[model samples]
Target: MPERVVPGRPDGLITLGAADALWVDLTAGSAVPTAFGAFTRSPARARAGYVLLGGRAVTTVRASGGRWSVSVGEVRRAAAELNAVGTDPQDLVRIGPFHGAPWQEADEETVLCWRRRIAGGLWEPGRPQRAARRDLDRPYHLAGIDWRQMLVERTRDGTQRTWWLPRAVVRLLDAAEHAEAQWLQASQTHQAGAAVTGPPSHPRRAARDAGGRQATDPEGPAASLRPYNGELKGQLYSVLSRKPGTSRGVAGWACAVCRTAPAAVLDHCHEHGYVRAPVCQSCNTLERPDHLYSNDIRVANRYTRLFHTDTDDWLRHWHRCPGCRARTTLPLPHLAAWTAHTACRSLRPTHRAPRGRTPCGVLRVSWTGSQNTPRSCLLTVTVDCCPSGEHRLLAQVPYREAVERFRVWLAETAPAVAAAAGPDRLDGLPTEPRPVVADTSGEGLALF
Candidate 1:
C-alpha cells in the first residue's frame, strides 16, 4: 500500500471533489474556533503550501479516512472569495470525499488523469471526444503551471502526497465549473419552457398595438408650432416660401467667417436687437464682440481688426531678440530702442545737480566718424523722469559699441545691482523712459 499522507489536519476536512476523485480539501480545524451564541465556529485555515481557490488557501488531502464536513464559516469565506473572482459559489455543486488510494506514481499520465476526472463534470456527453482533453489543457496552460517542478513527496510514515498546485490553475478550474453549472441551468430552463413558445412580443409593441396610437403620430410638428404663437411661424413660412432659391430645403446656410460649416443660428446685434444674418453656432457664440458700437461698416471693420486679425498677426510677427534671446510683449522696434536706452541710463552718476528733483538719464551714441570726432552722427536718448523737467545729457558712447555694452551689462552686471538694491529700492527707481526720436536726418542718420 502507498504511504497514507494525511493532508494538513485529519480531524475536520472539507473535501471538494468531482466524479469520485478528491480535488480540493479545505482544513476546517487548522484555525481556532470562535464562539457565537451556544455554538462554537471554526474559521477556514489558509495554509500556504496548497493552491489558493479565489485567492484563499485550498488544502487538499492525500490520504483517505479524514472526516469530511462543510462548516458555515468555511462556506462563507469560499463564497466571498469566489464572488470576488466573478464566480458565484451558489452555482457550484459540493461533492463529498470519496475513497481513493494515494497517488503513488507521480507522472504526466497520473496528473493528467487526476485533472481530467476532476474537471470532467463540466463536459457534456454531446461534446466532442477531445473536448475533455481541451478543457483540462486550458486551465493548465492558462495558469502557466510547470509540470517539471511538480514533485511527489513521501513522508517518514510512508504516505505519498502531491505537490502544491498553482493558484491560477485553481481559479481557472473554479471558473470553468461555474460556467458549466450556469449553462446546465439555462438549458434546463429552455427545455421546461419549450411547450409554451411562439415568438415573444415586446411589452412596448403590445401596448402600442392595443391603443392603435403613438405619442408623436397625431401632433409632433403641429404641437411644436403652437409654442411659436402662430404669428412668428406664419411670418417665417411666408418669408421662406417667397424666397425659394434662398430657403434651399432643410440644409442650413453656410457660416460667414469659416464659410464651410452649416449656419444653425441667427446672428444678431445685442444692442440693436436686429437679426444680422444666419451664421454657424460656433461663429455666433465665439466671434461676437464683447461690446459693439453703432452698426456702421467702419465700426465692424475696426472690430474685426481689434478683436480677431490684429492679435494673430502681432503674435505671428513676434520673435525673440538675437543678442539676449529674451521674450518681450513689446514689438521688435520698441524693444530694441528700450534695451539700448535702459543700458545707457544705468551708468554711474558723474555730477549731482539738485536734491528732491527728478534726474534725467541720457544716452548719446555717435554713429559717424571716429570715437572723438566732432562731425559724427549724435543719437541722444533723453529719459525724462519727471513731467516738468528739462532734458539733460548723462552718458555718451560710440554707436558701434553701445548695444554690445548694453547686452554685456544686462547679462553680467544688472542682476547683482538689482539684487543688492532689493525690490523696495528698485520700486522707488523711475519708470521706463519713452524713446525720443530726434531730427537726426541732417547728419545722414535715421533714428529708429
Candidate 2:
C-alpha cells in the first residue's frame, strides 16, 4: 500500500452557486470525512492553519456504508453553477454541502462558501472511504474559479447549517483556468498601481532590502516602506513589565536575589529567558538575562508568504522545511523565526546570573521549550543600601517574553518584594495578600 501523506493548506475558501451546485456537493464531501463516519472537530490538530484562511469556510460532505447519494437534479444544477458563476478578487461565489447542514438526512444539507483571494488551494473535511476507486468522498478542486465571498445562513434557523450559493448566474471556474470576475472588477477600479489596505504604505519590494537582507513590516502586507525590526524588543515590544514602582504604597516581596523590599522581579530567573516581575534596568540586563528581540515586520513577512494557503501545489512548494526534508506543520512565521534565529524562546545563557550579593531574596523561573527541554536562565541581583532595602538584578540590554504568563507571575510575586521594601512615598501599592515565603521553583510554567 502506498503511504498516504496529508498536506497542510494555507489559503482561500470554496463556495458553491445556489442555483446549480451538485458538483460542489461532491467536492465538499471529499473534504469532510465525518459524513463518511470519519470525524474531525479542529483542523489545527490534523491539518495546518495555513491550509484554511483565518476567516474562510469550506464545504463538508459525508458518506454512509461506503457510498454517497445525491439527487441527479442537484448534481446537474451544481455542475452548471460551478461553470457559470463569475468570480473576482472583490466578488466571490459560493456553493455548498448541498444546503450547509452536516446532518445525514434522507435529504442532505450542503454549504458553499467564498472568501478573499489572497491565497489559493484545495482542502477537504474528511478522508477517502477505504480503497474504493469510485469513492465520492475523495477531494477535488474548483478549477478555473477564484472564489471570493462566502456567507453562512442556517436553514430555517437550526444548529445544523445549510449553504447558499452566490453568483449563480454566470460561470466562473472552467476546465483548468480560473476566471475571477469580481477580481477583474477590483483590477479595473484600483488599477495596477495602488497600495494594499492599511499602514507602512510603499511600493512592494520583490526581493531583499538595501543591505541585501529580508525587510520586515510590523503592520501587515502593505506596511514595508520603512525600516522595522523583525526581532521584537523595547517597551512596545515587551510583554513583561521592566520596572518597579509602589503603586498603592505597600510592599510584600523582597527581591529574591537581593533580600530587600519589593520583589518586583517576579520569578527573576534567567534560565527561563524572561522576568515575571517588573524589573529594574540593571538587574534586567546584567543580573538577569531573559529578553528576546523581535521585529513584527519579519513575522508579518513570513505570515504573508506561507500561512493559510489554499492550493495543494502551493503547499508543497512553500512549506518544506529547509532544515531537513521533513514537511513542516508550523506556520510560516514560526518556521522562519526558527530558521532565522534558531527561534528558541525561554533560553538560558552560557554565563551565570548573579544569585544575590547582599541581604536578599531569590526567585527562579522554569519553563519548557519547543523541544520540551527544561530551560533555566539566571539573573544576578544587588540591593540598595538603606533601611528600606532594594534588591536589583541586571543583564544585557533588550528583552522579550510572553505577555499573559509574565503578568500572572508578577501578580503573584510583586507583593513579596513590596512588603520587604517597607513603606515608601510612591502611591497605589496593594496592602493585601500578606507576605509569604517566595517559591524559588517556578510553577504553572509551560510553552504555549
As a TM-score, model 1 comes out at: 0.16
RMSD of 2: 24.7
Compose the digit string of candidate 2's lDDT tens values, residues 1-448: 2111123311111112221132333344221111211112212111110111111111221112322122233234334434443333222222223322212211111111221111112222353111112423343222212222232233322332323223221122111111121222223444444445433312221114433222221121112112212111111202343333331111123222223222222332221232233321112222211111221112222222222231222232222211111212222222323222222222322222376333223212222222212132111212223223343322211112322232233234343322222223213322331222222221111110
Best by TM-score: 1
Cα lDDT for residue 131, candidate 2? 17
| TM-score, every prediction | 0.16, 0.15
Once fitted onto the true fold, the runs of candidate 2 whose alpha carbons sit more than 4 angstroms away are 1-25, 34-448
Backbone clashes under 3 angstroms, per model = 3, 142
lDDT of 1 by residue, 1-448 (tens): 2112345633333433220112122212212111111111111112111222322223222224532232233334543444343322212211101123212111221112234443243334675211233433322321111221221222212432122233233334333222222223333454455537744322111113433221111111112111211121112322443564442221234443434343334433221122334443334333322111121000112223322354332222121111112211222222223333445436424335566533344332222332223245233443333333455444444444454454444335334322332223322212432232333211111121
TM-score of 2: 0.15
Cα deviation of 154 in candidate 1 (Å)?
Answer: 99
